[model samples]
Target: MELKKVIILGTTQFSVMMCSILESEGYSVYAYSTYKEYLNSNFFMGCPVFLTEDLVELMGGVENFMILNTIGYSKLNTIRERTFADLKMREYDIMTFISQKANIYTDKIGQGCIVMPGCFIGNNIVLGESNVIYTNTVLTHDISIGAYNFIGANVVIGGNVTMDTNNFVGMNSVIKNRVSVGSYSIIGCGSNVIASIKSYSVYTGNPAVHKKNILDINSVNI
Candidate 1:
């Protein structure tokens, strides 16, 4: 019998990492993009590299492959969202990947999500589309996360927390229980968020404070 083909949408470290995960799950993996930086390579982590335009033909049509995006938190999740939307518009079979090494306790994860190894998704958590939860992250029970959110490694989101769309929670940050984080916000690394963060804002520090709105900030470290 032939194996199922999966075409990852980037050639970054995230894509490389996902290759191992996908292969372990008995899927044949490949990587491709229009970006020159990613296209510079002939193969990515043992998966053949191809141009985005040649994907359907190379794989013998869209029906022969499944798509997974690994754009990795660029432009506050908008770039990843755009990539996912493009594949969907092209009628590709985009898939959500939950690593076998992770512990999932919910069935509420939306399509196109990537839940990486060592992550713990607790019970009754609602995860919307295209969110990427990185390694070793802990999302406690009853949390609500909207679409296109990027959750970094080792981050811990407490129970009943609500995270809006296009938000980036940096590595090792801890969002307190019942805190509501608004859309398009950035919670910087190592933050201990105890309060609600407003939309389009940047918050950092131990007890996270409003640094500035995302629109006003020219650059973000995370």
Candidate 2:
């Protein structure tokens, strides 16, 4: 049997929780703390801890080490891109982490998919590559999410929901049962989606309405 070595960046409580999950899955974990206080915590006793600022210096010839970003923020796309770029330049393999407690009943979870703690996934959920599901995000039965989708924290997705590629679902957003969200669409934070959203649209507010076209804009923060 082969053993996987994973390195988690960011030394928050979330990082420790993820490390525990990975360790239970038979992966050797190294926790990187951005703050010195986190390094001294009892939660990281069994795992090797390092300073985030000194990653480049400490990563000497360590190939095939999976780096998981445990930072919780809305603007994660830019952060992920930057981190991946840096790791790639150094020839390190990047990896994603999904909690063992997550109720995943999917046929396949794509590469680079990160499922955070307290996430509840239902049966027959098909998720594409590079999708991130933050903490407490709930996807009911028969949900389908496309590639490069960012599902924010505490979002609730009802059963039979289909979301296309490159969609951004904001925090606390709720998608009603059987709703279909189109490609490149953006759901604003705290919005409630009750109907099918069109492609490249920006939907927001309670009972989500199509406010504008997100594709017209140059940049999305996430």
Report the number of the highest-TM-score candidate: 1
Across 1-222, the per-residue lDDT of candidate 2 in tens digits comes to 776567787666767876777877778885554535446653454666776545656766556456776654334344544554555565655575677767777757876678877898888889876678988999988888876677989999999998887677899999999989987778999999999999878899998898987654346664
Question: What C-alpha lDDT, on a 0 to 100 scale, does residue 86 get in candidate 1?
Answer: 80
Write model 1 residue lDDT over 105-166, tens digit each, in one string.
99999999999989999999999999999999999899999999999999999999998898
- Model 1, TM vs. native: 0.90
Cα lDDT for residue 209, candidate 1:
90
Model 2, position 13, has a per-residue lDDT of 78
Q: In terms of TM-score, how similar is model 2 to the real structure?
A: 0.68
- Which candidate number has the best lDDT? 1
Over 4 Å off, model 1: 1-3, 35-38, 216-221
TM per candidate: 0.90, 0.68
> RMSD, model 2, all Cα superposed?
5.5
lDDT of each: 0.85, 0.74
